[model samples]
Target: MSEQTTYEFHVAAQGDVLEQYITARGRNTFIMGPIGSGKTYGSAMRVFDQMCEQAPNSFGVRKSRFVAVRNTYPDLKGTTIKDWCDLYHNEDCQLGKFNQDFPPTHYLDFDLEDGTRVKAELVFLALDRPDAVRKLRGLQVTGFWLNEVKELSKAIVDMCDGRHGRYPSAAEGGPSWHGMIGDTNAPDDDHWYYELAEESHPEGWLFLRQPGGVIEVTVGKGEHAVTKWIANPNAENLANLPDGYYINQVQGKADDWIKINLANQYGTVATGQPIYKGQWNDVLHINNNKLLPIKSHGDLLIGFDFGRTPAAIIGHLTPLGKLRVLREYVSENMGVRSFMDFLVPELKREFPAYSKADMQAFCDPSGWGKSGNDENSPIEIINMEYGITAYATTSNKPENRWEAVRFFLTKKIDNQCAFEMSADCKTLRKGFNGGYQLRRIQVAGDARYTSVADKNKYSHPHDALQYLAQGAQGEVDYERTEQLRQTSEQTAAADSLTGY
Candidate 1:
């Protein structure tokens, strides 16, 4: 044999499952686990191995193609592509220049130790929009790898499935393998991936869930209490990691973070600091019991927040003084007229028992100003055109509105939360959990937060809720109060003139 260098493959104790994952053929295979569990490395190595296994032509060049997908182009550059390049960039492999044409592709040409040449093309795709699905329509590929499947939707997954097993053509020999491999951290329990892995379990699908490394145990009492993380039986890939890796990682992490990322459990874990913190509990605040249906009872309270993305929360004060958010409406890239059109019909269909007269609308105080081409204010439009009397909140100060919401959440009504939201109101639920959160700043080795909550997709729904709280809590009518004060001063002045 010509002077040759050999590389030996050593399997970690936790890598047995990955070996099994590579051998098992399925229409869809998901390798889900916690951080540093070798999920991405193992998956990428397996795909490379499979591509090398393809039969070579007369020239001894094995040809194959693959599509690696991510949620956005920026993520493709920073994450998936970077990881892939790190894995395959070696002396044996030659990475070709990137093809910047429609549906960009990167070429990898390498030789196995056996002198077999491997020619593989990887197409990096990002499904950032609904139209992005159309880009996958006419592609030919042996297989696909979806990195961080939680960021992707079901429609993108379904579309990718249809594009596999078409490469190398029948003339050069049919594709040796055809399927999809996905890897992700534990996502929300309601995510589509969780539904498929835990609930659906469709035929020809392989779902592998790794056990979490950290287990939290409560110790002591109240403020003096301590929480400890004990190594659990589910800790995999420890042999591949540095000593005390998981231990160091779990320090200063929230309970949800420990559970979702370290424990590898399916639950709603906020990526950032939760706005409501101790006030909102998924089990307590969001459940079948809390998301109860409501019929038209007393006067319906509709809180409206207007903007590029307008939102409305329809609620009613229960007999026990609790505010029950029965339904909600949100729209994007819509005008006031279009939103009203959608909202009016939806209200009619859902709350047929209640009419315009029975509804009292409370809007953002800023809606009092004229916006865009509208000659009248948003409140005026609702009252004049929609025939529903709408009033602006007493104050637009975020602090006051947020305090009202906090009061409502903490208060108990018959041993339950005074404020209850329907599960169907997903946007509002996300906001209360953490999507609407204060901005964190690091100062002198300590973390500090701004008083104002960050304005984002969650802000609109939360603003609607805030307006509702301000309305329900009976804020002082600032406009009317100011008017009365002015009138009183004018009358006193007139009386003084008469006395003079």
Candidate 2:
């Protein structure tokens, strides 16, 4: 190429949201949207914009380095890098050759209209590779772009956070901007992204959500109601997609998939039949406002389901017999003792008004089983090691436990349902909505689910909830059934005695 050959790069943000995302200057910024909402494009351009914004050094050259990261190598290469190349590599200008080594790298050297040269290095890395974390620990980039941030963990993001702002030493006019930017399609409610965007809202962090490509509307009425997805009139990046992109994408997809991927909603894709299918109503059972423990309402009933994944549900049984589930605790691969350690402090912190005396704890009868490492069972440990006394429920029968929960779910006390859950119980809400489910048995003729609910992240918490329900007046259903049995035997004996 001749020295006289000059290049100019031009790109525009697709929509208002994308424009806002590109211009956001938060120390940590992220954008979430549907499939073709220009999230990746906007984030990619933001890096270049930041590089050019940096002040020129003694040689009239603006310099910066940015890393583009994805959770897997295939995604980093196939999607993330492909999108970057499609934008920057064209006929009129060439950014630079992207080296395809272990960790791909690209160097961009261009001259701006102000006569200042922009020299930026873009590195692409994947977290799945064994050496990736080690390599990330050593990077000294000005900023980072987390492509599909939901696929990565908070640990990786935290690590990336510490590695930035160390590049372009102060002596050479340090970087004008140093931080991180990311983009992703809608993630599930259980994802860390949801916690950060919907709950935490940490300082110096900005999260923007673009309009969905589609909107869900319920058709029909009452028992006949069905959900239908229609194209959203205000979807972003429509000019760059096919005529019926959003509508066509939902052709044979599940409602959950359409809601999450196209509608840009936070929800899980249901695989099996929901455990509480028709019985559980999210709109009716889940309170619009967060529920807090009522001082007058009987003692807080805390239920536990112990195992590798220990779970607990805290709620109250009102004098009116209304069951209000306030909070839930779900952990992965944690022991009972450790889980209690994490939980007790949280309970105290969140519910300072309620003391140990105001709380009643119950556990699954299976908690009587001893752990391999310890002589005491989970229930024994809770009662003996900890000052809190946790009693084992009368029966761990699935049918009895299920009936106990169902009793409240279907029961109505003074017009409103006896069961209600706090808005903060996201996991439990998802479970009732369909995360806790019965595995569908593959058969050609008709659809059929297993006799029992499938074990999953949701099931553990649901188990705890069932225990809570049973302990808090739900056991009356079991006792009622037992009384019916005794009545039946007495009637038979009386009939025989009268058969003279």
lDDT of 1 by residue, 301-353 (tens): 88898988889998888878788887778889888878999999888888787
Pick the lDDT winner: 2
For candidate 1, the lDDT comes to 0.75
**TM-score list, all predictions:** 0.50, 0.60
Model 1 Cα shift for residue 175 (angstroms): 0.8
lDDT for 331 in candidate 1 is 84
Stretches > 4 Å off in candidate 2: 1-10, 72-74, 95-103, 153-155, 187-203, 267-270, 274-423, 436-444, 448-500
- On a 0 to 100 scale, what is the lDDT of residue 269 in model 2? 63
lDDT of 2 by residue, 375-436 (tens): 87887677656656577778888777876887788789989999999878878888886788
Q: Residue pairs in steric clash, candidate 2?
A: none
